[model samples]
Target: MATSSFSSFILIFSLLSFCAIAIPEPRPASWSSKTFGPDGPWNAVEVVIGGVGQNRTAVFPGHAWHSWFTSTDYCFLTSSDHCNDAGGYPLRNSGSSRVSMEFLQPAQEWMAGVRVAGEDGFMYLDDMDLLFKGDNTDYITKTSLAIISDQMLALPNGTQYPALLGCLSLGSPEANQTFVEVPGPNLNGTMIPWPLAKRGATPSSSFGLHIGSGITVARMQGSLFWGGYDRNRVVGDVLALDGGFYEPILLKNIAITVVKGASPFAFPSTSKPGLLAQGNSSLSSSAGLPIVIDPCSPYLSLPRSTCDAIASHLPVTYCPNLGLYIWDMTSPKTTQILTSASALSFTLPGGTNTQTLTIHVPFRHLNLTLSKPLALAPTQYFPCYTSSGTRASVLGRAFLQDAFLSANWESSRVWLAQAPGPNIQPGSNPVGILPGDTAIQSGGNDWATSWDGFWTPLSEKQANGTEGIPAPAPVGAGNKEGEGLSAGAKAGISIGVAFFAAGLIGLGILLWRRGWIGPSTSGFARQESEIALEGRHSVEMETAMPNSSRGGGWGPVEVAGTSVRDPIPLGEVDGTSSSSSKKGLATSGRHVRSLHALA
Candidate 1:
């Protein structure tokens, strides 16, 4: 019994241990760390928690914690208090006064936990490099590696920082760029303690501390992600295909013009609102397109401030339908000015309006190869008319300046070589054909016109009887219909087959009766025929004579073919002889009647 009890206890303990190991407790919020360069007053600093701990409360120094863009991926950091305690580190040091650091003037500061890498330190530029030692090094490494392991942030540019070491490239956050120091000094001319500042013990709206002496603060600048994108980069984001035959490249700003003709119900301008007065059109770039704005437009789903910022050009947007579209040439900024000069009526729900805009922008960057050199000395953007009455626009010098175009007529292959320009059709060489060539049309329509006739279509086969020749099908004819003979022909053939079958049956019956065929051919007719003939004969003989006309009453006639002969009077046969001549005459008449009946 004791052994059993001991076994039960052991089993329970093992089960509990297994459960604990399998389901781990929630991780601490402060498990990750952040690092800065040896230089003081660095530009733009953010403590990114690139892990499962994003939603967990973050305790930071001298600032309240607030959430920014919250999703499964990430949450922005803001200053706010009265939030739940993060599992990692609780803000510490409840005190009235705190340390501070001056960005503009780094010297003459008094506070606790003061550690300076250099006398006058400040981080400049978008990229930075630093080294950490002991505990600081470990913390930096932990944070950097943690964020990178999330696989959310990409380092395309070849730059290295204290904790993070990697290259950042195009389309990266670093490419966006930013400049602003996250952590600043407090009121006291000294550095603020991490725990105290995080806990709101010595909280200040800005990066300041409660101190008797004043300190010069720094104003750093940097981009979010990295360096902010330029106009060219912004435009490239649009018209980008993930997997396409043509590769897109950066297109520099080109000159352009906007046509003007005012009417009601115009596009984009009437729908969009801007700072301009009523009836005034203002076109600006939003996203990658040009947007026209009218005054007093209704607020969209976006925030009012955001909309205002966009209208004022504080932020750029490309909404083509909103009267903002990119053109071949012309700066987006210039287009706005042009609208004002033209006095174009821009209002909500404007009338039908037409505008002609010319821009020298690169339509697209293509990756192409040419099999043969193309001659573009005289013709440019010329039309390649096909015999099918379709036209293909060829790439002119305007599209492919200093670009090579190659074509192989035999292989029907064409390619744009070297600096991989845009794909455009080549002009038809009307003069290239030999003079008086039969392939050329009489109306000087070029060889292409005669290559395949347009109005006059050629048949699939010639009017000659040839087995291999292709033939055109009748209208509405399908594969099944084509496979079989005509319906009428089939019906006639079926009827002929039925008649032939009937004739065969009749011949078989005739042969069977003559013993030319088997017994079963007559179908049991021989016995029936014999029986019928005998029955007919017996019926005729019975009805012919009556029983009264017996034994030589009148007269007996002999059978012509048989040997048996007899002659008897009719009166004897009837068994009644008359008395005298008169009686005998009457009897003779009776006998004649009797004989007639028997016959």
Candidate 2:
């Protein structure tokens, strides 16, 4: 029995040691670390709307446009370095100056050429200017490496339109030339630029595109992560696709359900809860419809038949005067009628091992207002444009607001997740988009060990060469805990508190002494007297005659062609008149005389 007990003790000790060795280490608390490799999963610069400071936020007047603009200090081909400089002409030059032109192309009919480098690099333009701050360096470097613009559009007729980067001046008119040119047509009918076309063979030249959604409309500081995505922001599993041609991302099926009120119009009784499915053999009606995700467009462009089916249930009307279809929700009842009218669900094809992905869109996204360029006057409108032809259907910002998209160009695959709602707190954990793989492991780490096993108390350090991970900053250190406060800071805070308390007490005492705290006899009497005087003054002012009449006479009547005798005073007219009447008349006459004198 003693030998068996000893053996069991040895076995337990071995099992504990193995478990400890198998656990993974906890991540550092800093904003970023080198654990994810040198090419970071860095935090994307936030692009805020309607806030303070330069590049901190931009005011978007209308909901139609999604174009981003930043302030730029430099202009192309300008020799005047101090055009808008605060200093005089020919200011000091720096050795680190470099010059590059930035071509800004928005979905709107506007384009601009911004100078990003050289001696005139740090010049400032207006609020609409595109500034090349330090944050833009990554994009700039990636553009230079690719030696081509990524804004190319593939047409339906096997034609490709290469976007213009900008025209760079070589100091002379003849030497000035465009930076990137479109390659001639090829036999294979490939639409991709030559530089990006070779990306398949040369994977090193590839990059990723990550688009982040802001939680709330008011605090909508959306982010565009160029290389990777914030792992914490994603709500559901990330669905990956092999690749796409003209429309890179596609949806397999679309299901529309009216969650609350009755449809504003009518639909077929057979299709109570509308379901438009594709790909699966069961859903026949929605088999041929192709859907594309386009953030550039603010509205969802659907096929005419599908749009008609959906529109039949919406409470909208065509306003010929405004030249737009308004979602006549001006009335409170009409607005309430659509409290929870409809919901749109998008389904994507997933492989056997993975579950299919679906993104849900509420009626709130579809119900928006037209502002600025889209309308002559601001009007409530629904964004459901229809196209009868066999053009690819588009899912715009209305769909993306609730969905997070991560496009990895290197792998030619896109990962999408259901975005967290506005109420959800944002997390700082970011995960890198690895090249060539559609499948992603959670936490951006593939280690088999558990994270808890590696978590050691910060007070203990390993005697070996391995360094201990620093603990997270103490909670409320700089706030209520006063851990970050200096001796002088603590003293100042105490003094301030004391002064504030004393001031409050002094104010209360003064209010009490003045009988303002509660009603006192003397204070009440004084108020009553003031009120009585005001009442008397008002009566006297009302009885006083106009200045012109006051100077003319006291109480007389005039006829157009006849003289009328003035009426005698009450006291004089009747011998029985009281003394009060005489006093009132005298007071009135005195008030009338004073008014005339002031005038």
Candidate 3:
């Protein structure tokens, strides 16, 4: 009985070990990782713009030309699509529309109609993600807002109106080769792509924004993600945006404080709220102002009164020539302020457990320049401006440098978190945002165990089925067979193939060293030359011929008997008298006929 019991224990131990080896480990669901820019954080993928079969252009992060404010109170593409002929006429004549006409009928069908509203011109539903690579891998087909080109129009008195283009036509006659058209079925104005629409009864679709250093600094890069965010990129706890305004994201009870004295003041000061309430009525009297976050603007534009309060404490002077206040970095008084001024922090409303959201901007980040073309020269400046008659304060790219913003349009909520600086490396693994009301960590065990003691490889559908979400179509796959393996499995197979290729290269080198392969041809061939007749008249060709004079040494030589003109040089001849030499040659009938026969 003791021997039988010991044998049963051994059998059970052996089975457990086999199960551990055969079962694949469960991993969190995630979208494929993409890189960030021409220069950006480590391990982050770089972003490029343009369409498939078109010239792809790298999107330079922190590039002033490409930045813009998030749309508020309007779907720019929708407005452009329904625009009248006055708005649509310009696109038909513009360079982008003419090229779209040239594409095959199938490609032309996908072209979103064009809109040209005076100076505000745009094309709708046209731009696409550069990484799509001819496949609808991200389910990003028939979406809006791909290429935006905003042109500034000068108005009366110096006021400028920005003409925003939802879809920019790359219509330059020279650059026609670079336009890439989106591939798929035609989408009507009302139809929304599955990816952009609300997902699984959720009120909002999730997206993450990581804005890197502005153009003032080098190696700047930014990241934008749809459906989820990189937790590793954020430093502090995620905070909720204020609950008013259906269009723009807003923050409440905002308070700003400058560090005083020798030691730097601790940020998010606990006593300042009460102190400001007692001392400064201008700041304390009102609730937080409606604000819009714009990545395109370099400076922070605040209410004129608020700017007056902040400027009173800092060492700043107004420049009449530039029509703006400049921070004199060279002044001794400014130097003293810089030493004590550690940072400026903005406090916002955070829901419940997380009481408040604060983003701290360092003094060094405030130092910037009025870049060329925007200014006459590169001028030292601070990133603060005053605005009058504005509905909301603008928190431009300057503020975003220190913050990570994520927006969930389907849920109608925005997440604000303090960002890791520009140099941090990205995490190897990233998780996708699950549907609303679904537990983030559940369903993995059930899917892993569904094989029921039979170890079958998990397909993408099976994994997504366990999570109660539909799997996106595999990129570039031609049929269902192509979808059998997951992206991770394909990546592993690719690595194996690379190793095999390296081994073959080593074998070729060994064979070459042992003289098993013969030498290759130099690619040149030899040809024989025939000798010229002794009595043949030789003509000297002029190295440089005059434009007006035709009868040079290299000019046509007329044979006496034949109408054909031979261009052979008989002797040294000048451009001036080649005609006389030709006449003499024509008189020698026998010699000319002999030359003609040889010609």
Candidate 4:
């Protein structure tokens, strides 16, 4: 009797299912945003690693390495313990705080980045204690470890970490290729990119960076973003790299120009040879030039031939023993080059059939300094170093100082744009770069929103500001908003509203059949598909990455883990900067006829 009654109810429900009705799709949820304090989704967020000065230590976090900060970004270990190597001078802070590090893993993993005074540095990763949570960002703020790199160490004659620490061996929660992945047994460690994604704060594993200009010129603090980019930091055309986000860029030309008379005098022209090509570039020999962008890299490591060419024009001398150019303080050429020079331009494929991209790094930006073990006293030097022949040449912090970079794992896309010059403060408005297929949306809100004026969408601005081609518009948009509805909009609404009533009636009937509402078939609660909550206490995720044939060449410092000789971390960056006047504006202009030329 019960089976016959159930069969009769199913037959009636199937007949009612033919009604025309609609169900709206649910909105995607994400973190909300703000103009100050906490950053919005995909906006700039500062990750403090080291503390500085004597008075402000209390305000910093627990893991902050309180050390003396320097303008020139010389990489150092903050721990107090010294290594076996006593040959070099250390770049660190006070005597109280030393390099606080412990190495538990047995394998000495060979890493890339940060060319050391000796060799590349390597360290081990501890796995058991860390989980990525939006509230507690240990994977970013302070390191969660049992023990790490206690063996091979250098830097800090006896001090602590200062300023910011950029790149590390921390692997992405998704793919290590996205963030700095240290390929272990199976991509074992977790880093910054993962937490943002796991928490739904970011649409995907992505980050944007703009290190800001030198203190001498801009005095701007660096900007960092998770899963999104600041729309204002970039100016001119946005170049989408042809290669993978993990690979090097193709350099079309590099020219240094000096203003002479009316036009600009330039060198390293196609025929003149300003910058040379690197043989060790990941690309083919004929492919223009390959340059890796590293925030931790303090100096601009280029081809030796390029350095030779640049040296001949300036007063700086290359001391092969030191692997750097020495600025002869007494030379008149030194003074002239520093003040009279105009710009050093690096031209790249503009991502268009017609236009090309050019980033003019101010000649004044190349000024750098060396102190202590590397030098007897503080000395100013040009920041160009000959590229080590092992891997691709590096376009370190020196270049990033004037360039904008954005990376995304979901889209596997990387973008490069010219950074704004000194004294120009652009507003902060971060937009998220959503997941695979890379359909971008308004990040701070769960629903997708289109970012206007993001790519300089205006016609006039696109022409003068962008330089040439712009990247594609952001993908995806949420509910539409407007003052008045158009014919199509009105029609869509009418259909939607009409279906709403019908949909409710259908829902009632379905509920009744399922013993959900006003029903008495069995009288039991039905299981819900999903639940909304106010958030939990903890969020955990797995870590690892696939092996890749590509990587950047870092350095010689070793953090004695396991001597298996495998690729490791990318180095850190900081440059000595001074922004006094270039000297003799009218004086130099009058001498242009006898001074120099553009080409």
Which model scores highest in TM-score? Answer: 4
Model 1, span 1-599: residue lDDT tens = 99988755555554454344333111111111221111111111223222222233221111111011111212112121211222211112212221111111111010001111112111111111111111121011111110111111111121121111111111100101111122321111111111111222212111110000000110111111111111101100012111111111111112211122221112333222342222222112321111111000101112123223323421123332221212212333222222111111111111112212211211111111111011112111111111100010111222222122221111222222211111111211111111111121111222111111111122112111121222212231111101346679789978865755555555555556788666454431211000010111111112122211111121111000100011212222111111211111011111223211321
Model 2, residue 156: C-alpha shift (Å): 20
Better of 2 and 4 by lDDT: 4
Task: State the lDDT of candidate 4 residue by residue for 1-599, as single tens digits.
Answer: 99988756654544444343111111121111211100000111222223222221101001101111111113244321211111111223322322223222111112112232222222223221122223342333222221222222122242212222213322221332111222333222234355446554455666666655433322333445566766555666777753234344557667665422111222333223335542334222443555556544455667776677666666688866545687887764454444332456787775565667777565445655564335556576776766332244566666776677776655666677776544332235566666653332212221001122111222332222333334423232211112235689889988866756455666667768897676356632322112111121111101000010111321111111221333332222111111222110000000111100111
The C-alpha lDDT values of all candidates are 0.18, 0.32, 0.34, 0.38
Candidate 3, 1-599: lDDT as tens digits = 99988655554554454344333221111211332211111112222222343322222222110111112222233333211211211232222212121111111011111111121112233333425323233322222222223333222124433322122111110101111222322222111112332222112244455555543222234545445555544565566643211113334443444433232222334223322123346445544443545443334655555555555555677543432457877664454334333445666655554487777665445555653223454565656655312223456556776677654433445566675443333231234554341212111112112111212222333322332222222222111111346689889989856755555555556557889668886642312122121343432222112210111111111111111123233222211122223221221111122111211
> For each candidate, what TM-score against the reference?
0.14, 0.41, 0.47, 0.50
Order candidates by lDDT, high to low: 4, 3, 2, 1
**On a 0 to 100 scale, what is the lDDT of residue 286 in model 2?**
33
TM-score of candidate 1 relative to the true fold: 0.14
Q: What's the lDDT for candidate 2?
A: 0.32
Clash tally for model 3: 21
For candidate 2, lDDT tens digit of each residue in 144-214?
10111123222223232322111110010010111211122111111111122132211221222222232
Q: Residue 501 lDDT in model 2?
A: 55
Backbone clashes per model, in order? 95, 8, 21, 55
Query: Which of the two candidates, 2 or 3, achieves a greater lDDT against the reference?
Result: 3
